[model samples]
Target: MTQFASLLLLKTVLLSGLALWLSVVVVNNLTAFRGGVFSVGSMMAMQLFDQAPAISTPLLSRRVTSEGWHRLVYGFVVIVEIVVALLLVYAALASLGAFLGYADATAAIGYANLALAGFVAMGLIMLVGGAWFAYYIRQEGAQITHFALIGLGLAAGLVINIPTP
Candidate 1:
């Protein structure tokens, strides 16, 4: 089709790919934490939830250990997944804005760049958490897999941020 339509399609594909990747990472991390391993990723993920208590006195009031910690970790994973999904939606809108020429290229780039950064950060968090979970589960075998997924996410984010030719 037209050049604009082609660009729009590329944007859609990138955002959808990002969302799908993040969802897979979240699900796999959770599953491994609950059933497979308790590696470093699991511990790191748990730490994110642990920090919430320090930032908020109310969360601190609630106990955070054992089963409590498990729930907290799971919650954090879910939250991260939700944020990734939202970012993908925003990415689509930003792409549409760009394709329609309703917004400047700079603005479109900014939105995509911001979303990419956010995804990368989230992916890092997921990696750490997944590693910790694997450690806890005593499944050191899965550490490499977790790292691979993180790497994939980072690479995808970087590719999406590249300026269109």
Candidate 2:
């Protein structure tokens, strides 16, 4: 294969890797959601907000705290995660299309824009949910490692989204 073909192969592979990674994360979240783990996680994260905003402050609801808000935010995060997973799936398909000659930079970049946005959100979600939640401080928190791993995973997606020429 020529240089351009090699670049195309690399892009395709990276996108595939990103898609697979995001799929795994989404599945894990879904499992956690089913297990009612997100509820606990959200509460813990919110607790940090009130007592530890110096440690973990949410964007809009930092001041108006309540259990109602915690549940509300948890629901919102679940929806956002599902949307992010959808975006990743779309980007992977577009990447495959690019490989197969059915798509181009515009198409791939379009899907990638959405996926990249989701990746950013995923990184922040883990940061606030883990780092800000004092997961790193906790001796028993399971999410400390998950937070770091997911943040790295999202960063990898950004690297994969870089345009190749």
In order, the Cα lDDT scores of the candidates are 0.59, 0.62
- Cα error, candidate 1, residue 36 (Å): 11
- Top candidate, metric TM-score: 2
Writing each residue's lDDT as its tens digit, candidate 2 over 1-165 gives 766556666766766776686678667766776444545544454444444334443442423345565566566666766777677778778877877778885678677777867767765775675444455443235565555656665665566566666
TM-score of each: 0.59, 0.64
lDDT (10s digit) by residue, model 1, range 1-165: 776557656766777677666667666766666552333333543444444343333333333346555656666766766776677667767776777777665565566666666766665775675543434243344556656656765775565566665
In candidate 1, where is summed lDDT lowest over 10 consecutive residues?
55-64
Model 1 scores a TM of 0.59
Q: Where does model 2 exceed 4 Å of error?
A: 32-71, 139-158, 161-163
**Model 1 segments beyond 4 Å from truth?**
1-8, 20-65, 133-142
Q: Give lDDT: candidate 2, residue 1.
A: 75
lDDT of 1 at 151: 76
